[model samples]
Target: TAHRWIGRAYFFAGVFPAGIAVLGVAPLSSTGFVSQVGNTMLAVLWLATSIAGYRMARQRRFVEHRRWMIRSFALTTSIVLNRAWLILFVILLLPHVDTTYGGDQDAMIRAAAGASAWMSWVVNLLVAEWWLERGDARRRTHRTGQAADRRDAA
Candidate 1:
């Protein structure tokens, strides 16, 4: 349960930045007053969620501190991975895609920048989720084995 909450918090933290960035990139005036308000709410919610998660972890209610720590680390790592992915995508994938799409040099640069940014965000989110899930699974398995050993010893 605590682990799940931590995961949710981390998920929201990642989403908040991405959402803010998206809104920053978008033509906000194209939307209405409500949209702007909603964006602000999202930013607030993101911060709240992150704080709640940290508080929960500090409480140390769950014996699965290892699991939570691994998850927190994995979540924090997305930032680094996101930047790396963006750089690689721009340098490698974007050029190929632009050329295949028959864009001129200037057009290709613009397209690559736009596409790489979006793709990098998506890829980073997916990879972060996968890493967290895998880490959780591994932790669970190790815990189960330890429990079994204790039982056998008794």
Candidate 2:
């Protein structure tokens, strides 16, 4: 399964390094403490979800595996989504940051980064759950249609 393979690749390449950097190097840096902590937790969550998905796949619990994969994928894409949020923040709020952060540019940037960091993954996860529910509903509809057709044939 490509999904399983992709999960493996993403775990090794993306999540692992993020965990290492966040848990280790970020602490040494003198910037963005709140965002660093949030992202560190996010990295840990991503790793946990990725491993859970792999375990479900190994156990042949494919439906559960798919659900976890969707979560993992959402977390993975949050990096990109984070940028999108940051862009929105910049466009919509950067100019008004003087009133918000009292003209402290660094503070404003950090606040934006932290908010985007948290929002990206949280929003994506919500959307993923919505997607999963939609998939479940569609599958249920399809099964119902199939059952009706079989009864008619009999």
Candidate 3:
């Protein structure tokens, strides 16, 4: 379908470049292990999920393809989620924990930043897995009920 191809094009063109910029270039401009590692982790995740989705599509597993696509979308959104978390941490949570790390602002910020970076995609992927599994379970249940209904009718 056009929709699927569009998604593929976007991933290949838009997302890949942005991901490269973030993972490859941002670290060079910034000073810290967290950004470099975090960006790399996210880029790796994106690449893995994209490949999984494409493989599913190629194998004619439409349902699995949809599931993988959902997972890929979730991972993509994680970048925005990470920024949102950082903003929330800066506004509401960071002040309280500011004194924990010997009141060193930079240390506390780095810790929070690292935590948020990991949490963002990790949580998104977990939620995506749950959603996919839940839908599959429902389909199974529905199919089972239909079979029982047919047997009773016969």
Taking every candidate in turn, the Cα RMSD to the unseen true structure, in Å, is 8.3, 2.8, 2.4
Question: Candidate 3's residue-wise lDDT over 45-143, tens digit each?
Answer: 787777788789889898888887898888889988998877776666466664676767776677667767777888999999999899989999999
Q: What's the lDDT for all of these models? A: 0.53, 0.81, 0.78
Which residue ranges in model 2 land beyond 4 Å of their true spot? 1-7, 25-33, 147-154
lDDT of each residue in 14-131, candidate 1, tens digit only: 5546646745744352333433444344344434444554556568654344444444454445446545644664576555654565645544444444544444334544575687
lDDT of 2 by residue, 54-136 (tens): 78988999989989988988988988988999878777768877898888987877877878878988899899999999999
Ranking by lDDT: 2, 3, 1
Global Cα lDDT for candidate 2: 0.81
Best by lDDT: 2
Comparing 2 and 3 on lDDT, the stronger one: 2
Candidate 2: RMSD over Cα atoms?
2.8
Among all windows of 10 consecutive residues in model 2, the one with the lowest summed lDDT is 22-31
Ten contiguous residues minimizing lDDT sum, candidate 3:
23-32
